[model samples]
Target: MPETILQIPVAKIIPHTLEKHGHVRTDNYYWLNQRENPEVIDYLNRENDYYQQSTAHTKEFQKDLFEEMKARIKEDDESVPYFYNGYYYITRFEKGKDYPIHSRKKGSLEAKEEILFDCNEMAKGHTYFNLSGLSISEDNTMAAFGIDTVSRRQYTIQVKNLVSGEILAVKLENTTGGSTWASDNKTLFYSRKDEVTLRADKIYKHKIGTAADKDTLVYFEKDETFDVSVYKSKSKRYLIINSSSTLTTEYQTVLSATPDAKFKVFQKRTRGLEYSMSHFGDHFYIVTNKDKATNFKLMKTPEEATSKENWVDVIAHRDDVLLEDIDIFKDYLVVTERFNGLNHIRIMPWSGKGEYYLPFDSETYMAYTTTNLDFDTEILRYGYQSLATPASVIDFNMKTKEKNVLKEQEVLGGKFDKNNYKEERIWATAKDGTKVPISMVYRKENTKNGNNPLLLYAYGSYGVTMDCHFSSVRLSLLDRGFIYAIAHIRGGEDLGREWYENGKLLKKKNTFTDFIDCSQFVIDEKYTSTEHLYAEGGSAGGLLMGAIINMAPNLYKGVVAQVPFVDVVTTMLDETIPLTTGEYDEWGNPNVKKYYNYMLSYSPYDNVVAQAYPNLYISTGLHDSQVQYWEPAKWVAKLRILKTNNNQLYLDTNMDAGHGGASGRFEAIKEIAKEYSFLLDLEGIKK
Candidate 1:
């Protein structure tokens, strides 16, 4: 390791006092929240300079790691073509390009290719670019797409005349980067975000050739806690506007053929009722938690009478099974469920035939229905993958019980082999006697020794399950004697909805303790010891990284937190921040005394103490809309002043990206290389 002495960047502190629930606290690094302040930019730049200087010796090694990982990825990769509308759409990448080219073939794959958008050409001259919500018109002559150049997720919607290959003149600003076209191709509906909070609170209708300012406001979600979006139902009959919060949802619908018709509420919002609608033959299939169905259930209501009272159970709630989602087709209704912490795809014939689950051989794997757009077809498209196996896109015949693998992710390196790797699922007992699951993978040659370095990762919030899936980049760690594990902690719906319920709001500490328990279990089982264990997570999972280190800093040797939401109380209290208001149900509204007290107790920034801590690598994006850059910036600034140990602490801020980091495919690989290099360097692995 290089012993070059470097000056650490110390942010200027101007103490700011905040009082909430009659409690006062002083924050010295609060000024870092000033996104537009010159001093804030100076501090971030200095921090970046320090990072560059501190890791200067690893530059060549980082490059090697980047190339090694890049080699594993097939440069000219393409996604499985799914038949939708009148065309078969495909997204493919050229051999050396950083972006994808969207193209389509009419009627069949053998037809002449019609280039929709070559993103490589579109992304030119921009540091960051994202093309989202590509909605094709009913007539198949036009396409509406959203473009975000600044990376804050505020997209600009524009239309393209596919027939003439020319971008239309009108542009819609401040949208959520998606639009839904009415049956009349000339009319489109989209969701717009609030300029300050970045909340999708308004739905608007626009005519193709008109100015964006003249677009009519179809609906405005007055409740600050709710966000709205517009989309066309799969049946292509209705245009639906969905308004949702963390715990509640309401939808409005109108016939797509009548573009100017007013939308009628399908169901009124209730505080604890969460539901989603899918249009079918004569009714709308709903996946909901109404009537206290904690794990959710499948229900349906006639299209003419759309309300809670008219809803009838299609599939009753089961205590042990979580109804995650459903896909409707002309002859079969496919349901995606989670049972015993594994994905199960259930197929039921609409003609009253018996239903059965698709067989899966892996003990821990991710399987879900992919794109099944053609309703008349008997074949159902789905995806399957595990820690050791590459992802395979499969087409299953719902009637014949036959399946065909269309494409499998190719690991380009010659050294790769699925047979050489091992995957396992283990259980850990939490502090509350609750059992948590951990999915792990490593090279078969690796032994369960305390000396082996293990990287434990998780994201335990938003009822989002972190499934065990394949990753070519992960082979680098496994081959280097690293055991990669994901802790299915309480905040996720890994086990069921109850798992998520127990880890959120006032019970949020369960998430932190669940992770700590998993860490201890791995060590106790000789998978890895404290000195050889490390942690990693991003976004809400980044919050997990922050909390775990604060709660059990001595359990691991180091931690990597990407775009961490460390300043919990401060962020939750400020409604102007993106995602704050909508997440009140997840993290209790801190305005109340009880919630404020509980949040302050475990808030990472508030709980930073004068004690020894683990070596840390933190990352953030300057334009991150989900978790503002200031949260991590303020955290690092505070940690520097109060931490009692001289451990390695580094912060890398992506100057030209947002929460997901670099927009280019290869550029994203470079970020991963940097992270892996940090881990390998700590273990004294040079190559």
Candidate 2:
């Protein structure tokens, strides 16, 4: 078959000059920003068509890849049931179903089952549906959950009478898709976002059998920088309203038993201070960065006195370790900590005796606490996984120190063997003599020092650490002699808080450089070269992908960016866009001249110049609330005009989804298949 050449999309140029900080930028593709304009819709559809036509040769291959990946998954599967509040909740999927069925059994796992909500049924007749925040009333006779028919993430709150199996007449719209139930069982507190900015600003209290208009506005956050949310304390003693900005946090509390009581602030917000609280028997445990504890520490305050002055150190600050989270029990305090690069769960008795760490064999692995709902029990349930190991749920007896494997994810088809793969943690040297960590995995037979096709990935923003976790989809690459690696660069909390602090704001360039440095380090060490290397990330990580490709165009043969945030300066300056205002702390406010110039230096859309570029595959969702779809559309339009190379550049815009491409479990697999095939086709790999 003769190859069919694709006609590149030429977006109509409408000059829009954005003047800020005594500077002016004339955007040629700015007309694409008119989302409601039919021209904009037509242009996006045309681009999608071009992408499909360009990759038409791989249509059959993509289907095969999707099927191969889907086969590894257990078709009829049920998660490990966790007991919570007099019920054992379990989520299961039937063989051909696209969504999970949420159900519960009373008292014991063998007891009669009661279905909460079958998502497969609820998701029917809708292109996108998401159900979240399923909060059961304290009496266990009612349930309140949030649902979204559109992909914009704005959900409507729905109530159901569990005993009667009837949905109530009450409905609340524009919610954040979460609700906290009070001890009264009939009262619920939910958070709603600003209609325009989508900033979660208002928390409301709703009583059963009342219209949403009558719901009381319990609290309203005046600060645009801070977002608010509500949740019940683990002890169920308090309903906590947490308001947090990028750098600071403030928490208000109301007795869960007294739903109508006024909430009181535990501690006033202080700039640069961040803290989160959990309640135990007589005190509140605070994980905070108070007193310049860069890596954070645990402190305790009497239940009666929660002011900052009353807080005393329970766990002292450590310079080398980052305290991630803590789980309190009747006799044990299990702290999830990060030292070096791997996660560690350290178990300590309340009596301060017999302190130990749960041992993990993998050099690079993740282990964290799961739903340990009952504080009176000695058993701790946690999830554990690594690059080579499948996810496993374990129940550990704190007293006897016996660990029982409750469930290890079954990679169906009987073809997977743990012994055939090898995983390792390696360090890549950065420019300033700092050692960045990288977690790598490959089939044991392909581990020899050779220039193999390697996919290096990282998300270096928002203090979000990318851990070494197993993925059944990744096995497809591994089996094809491709090494998968995760770069634990700065901006991520993988190493410690200091690691994140150094890669953000004025020092944000470290993130881009760290990734480039890792790329060069891996290639120098003979893992892969520029000819065989590939890179991938999504959302904020997509921002990482955009920046790195501009900084080092020759670093990889191809790059995959999903729902990328490419137009930084323009997006940040416009506060009307969703998620733009709250992220000023992550990517500095471009309104200020200094930050404007800094962001402009690396803004991918602005940095596209007349130069040779690598093969590129970019994707976005038309309804993405996080990064507006037009950002990627405008970027591709500009790249088509300036890029000097003819290397393949394909853009896929999923019209049926939002920030997340697809809602169905199997449907999402097909998106991954498209991405994997793009990489494999470039490398000339075939089954």
Candidate 3:
């Protein structure tokens, strides 16, 4: 079939000039930010039409790819049931259902199943639906849940009578999609979002039967750089309100038993101090970066004296190991630590008895504690997975050292074998003599001759580590002779706290450079070449995609930037945006001249020039709250006018979705199928 010739979308330029710190920038497509304007909507619709017409030839192939990927999943699946609060909670899906069925059984698995929420039925009438923050009262008779139908993440809180299966009359609007219930059952605390900025700034107390307008504002966060949230402690004794920025945190707490009691400050906020607290018997366990503990440490203080002055070190700081988190049990204290870019769980008893680490065989795999809600249990449930292996939920007895595998993800279709694939961890040398790790997997039959198609992915921001884990959808590429790899570069807490510190603020260029170096290293090692290499990332990682293409346009054959935050300087300057003010510590505050100059030097939208760029497939959601839809739309507009070569640049916008495309299980697979079809079509592959 002959390809359809489609007209490229041309956005109208309204010339908006922004100035700060004695500098000026003129934006031509800035008018696209007017989302409600008819012309802006028309432009987006036209781009969607162009994308559909351009890829029309792959319609059948995309379907086939979608089916091929979806067939590997078990349509009827249930999560491992975890016992908590006298019930075994389970989330399962029917064979043809699009959403999960949240259910539970009292006492044992053989007991009668009680359905709490059938999301499939709840999502029937809405184009987009999300149910979050399902919190049950201590008596287990009532439940509070948050619902969002617009996909903007401003959820409405509602209560439900589990015994009668009836929704309550009260509705709380503009909430953060979660609530914490006090022991009284009638009182709940939730964070409210600013209607304009969508920042959770106020914590409110709402009674079960009262109107939302009548709810009491318990606490309001005055600092624009911080957001507030409320939650109950693991011990269920205290209701804690936390206000935090990227580098600092302050907490206030009150007894959960007394819903009307005033909350007292646990610790006053310091400029750079960060700490998180957990309650046990008589003291509060705190993980903090006090006294210049870069990687953080564990401390404890009496319940009455919650100030920093009363805190004494329980577990001292280690220079090489990052203390990620700690979980308390009746007799054992579990510590999640990261060493050499790998996760380790250290089990220590309260009596200072024998302490040891869990044994893991894989060189590149992800392991972490999962769903241990009961505080008196000796069984530690943890999850484990690698590039080739499926995810497994295991229960380990901390005393007897016995391990039982409760469930391992069943990959249907009977064509998968763990032994048929090879997984490895390789290091790449960066420009500053630093070694960066890369986790990759490929079919054993594929040889490294610099001719294989490789998709390299990374998300280097906010100290979020991208661990190596299994993916059934990725099998479509692996089975077709593609090598998939993850770049554990700077800007992530992969190696240690120092790794993230060096990749943000004035040193943010290290993230882009590290990725570029990893690409070159793979090419030098004959894993893949520039002609067949691809790059992918979303959100802040999408920012990485934009930066790399502007810096080294010749490194990738094609790049996929999903909901990318490309307009760094412009977005950072607008505090009204959802995450701008709160992320000042992550991406430096652009209002300052020093940060403004540094940010502008590498901001992707500002760096576009007349160059021969690689093929690009960009995607965005019209209702995305994190990275606004206009950023990608404006970027594509700018790239269209300046790029010297026409190498298949397509922009796909999901009008019905947000940051995450499609809410259904099968519907999400179709989006991935479209992305895979793009890559496969570029490789001249068709089923």
Candidate 4:
């Protein structure tokens, strides 16, 4: 056999890499002083100003294109008739509320003419946006809803009186997560986070009537240095809290409890891979992989949900796909699973049954659903389609076997045929002989034109897949003779575990190589010329852009790295930074010399050898608690210094914005427009 390669620990290699510092891959210390790269920094500063100005001057866009873009984001009504106590309610979009619609229910779905929360109205009566995680009091007199900014930063909790179309309360802000009320509706419980401690995500529960700080401290997570999210289970009496591992390859912990008490571990899965728990009558259904490392199974437990020892396996995944979505109600269990590259939704027939063989309906993209007793009334299982079928709001009648499209977004009204925009799935081989799949959409009229400009996008880290999703953004590009492509390379969940396993930690180079391969595939096939191509990725995808810029400079003409994690070694090594410690699992602990070396090798900052790079723009937000702006700010500075090519390198750190800039919808669209404008300038596209 060829020599078995024994990889040295990153701890061992980092000292050497640092020893060779300032040399830009040459391993020399002369490069330590960042000031030596002033010229490069200055050039990049100019590029940064370019993006900031273009975005600032968004009024330059053609009136027709601007108007057309605005017309595409329309939402249909899924009016639900909720009648409780002495109140009647109809929930519909509040028109004229700014860029995106804000919603509230005035009467039930059967109400004569829908009374919407007026968009022209301001303050509490008119919310920032639609109510997510809506919970009406069991009595229906009080409606508790949540409104979030486009980026989900300014999460505000609101309570409305059903009959008056009036706002009762706008309780909190700066809240990232949300919660709801108990059956009595007198008391409400929700979680809060203080970004002060970067390590552990501390959660707090606030009772609606009490002072904010006086909210009950129901649970103080033992692991303060990790991520945590809690949800109310189907029983309504119990809650499920999930805590992820911080510094190791540990499986997430699932805890159970009621609103007033501490949570107890329902299951302590070792190699969890992925898991979810749902409650029915006497048994609790949990999908886990305690039995197999990569596989999952649906198990039923009669013992108290919190007792891990009592949990036993009932059914597990026999194939590659796991039990993705499941619900336990009244007498039945509804589940969604994957099979043969497709998703299946099914309703199992048993007190507690599962092969996880399939799901109840494969056609709908169900984020979640609630069912009534006997599992007869499937309350809400919403979904939408991309490319062909625009978004639709559906209410499935489990008992009658009938489905109602509560709201189907109206697509282009006969101007552009539905069939005109088609999705093409293609696969191309990478430099490492790996096959990377790509999804694209383009106008049918120009199907024969391979020379059209292209916008290639990807987010190939953290097991994130460039999964198919409907987007008005893609439509905008495709309509403009621009082909939009998603590069589902390794490091994402596109093909499950194996895809990610091959591209992270010591093998991190695969992320960049895979992206480069995608660029080459499109170019070699003449789908688009390298000069006309553009790449964009955010956060971990930002790391992707940084790597691509260094590894394959000539591949693309322009690039947009938003909130990029480009300074790999520095960011991962610096535990003082907010998101650094939590990322050790995805990116090996940089303090370890082994990981240090591995990271430094691919770190765009450390590897910025004197060379030409594409026209690049790097962006970050001052308040991005996750990926701090300094990492990109520093990398772009270093890149400008080390780069030998005269191409432009832009740096934009939005002082007013957090990780996602601009809270308003119009501002958000302007941000997109600015990036597109920069790309057009770089590609010389006349618009």
Distance from true position, residue 658, model 2, in Å?
0.8
Task: Give the poorly placed runs of model 4, Cα more than 4 Å off.
Answer: 1-48, 52-59, 62-64, 75-96, 99-107, 112-175, 198-200, 246-262, 268-274, 303-309, 339-341, 351-380, 397-403, 412-414, 447-450
- CA-lDDT, candidates in order: 0.93, 0.92, 0.94, 0.61
Q: Write the residue-wise lDDT of candidate 2 on 1-687 in tens digits.
A: 986566778998889998987788999988888879999999999999999988888999999999999999998999999888899999999999999898999999889989999999999899988889988887889889999987899999999899999999889999999998999898999999999988999999999988889999999999898999999998999999999999999999999999899999999999998999999999999999999999999999999999999999999999999999999899999999999878899999999998999987788788989989888899999999999899999999999999999999989778889889989888999999999989999999874474799999999999999988899988999999999999998999888998998999888989999999999999999998899999998998888898998889988899999999999999998889987888888889987888999999999999988888888999999888999999999889988998898888988999889998899999999999999999999999866
Looking at candidate 3, the ten consecutive residues that score lowest on lDDT are: 3-12
Candidate 3 Cα deviation (angstroms), residue 305: 1.0
lDDT of 3 at 568: 96
Give the poorly placed runs of model 2, Cα more than 4 Å off: 1-5, 447-450
After TM-score superposition, the amount by which residue 439's alpha carbon in candidate 2 deviates from its true location, in angstroms, is 0.6
Where is the poorest 10-residue window by lDDT in model 1?
3-12
Model 1 Cα lDDT, one tens digit per residue, 446-532: 887798999999999999999999999888899999999999999999999999999999999999999999999999999999998
Which residue pairs show backbone clashes in model 2? none
| lDDT at 344, model 2 | 90
Model 2 per-residue lDDT at 182? 94
Candidate 4 structure quality by residue, lDDT tens digits, 485-559: 888888876665557767777777888888888888888787798878889999889888888888888888889
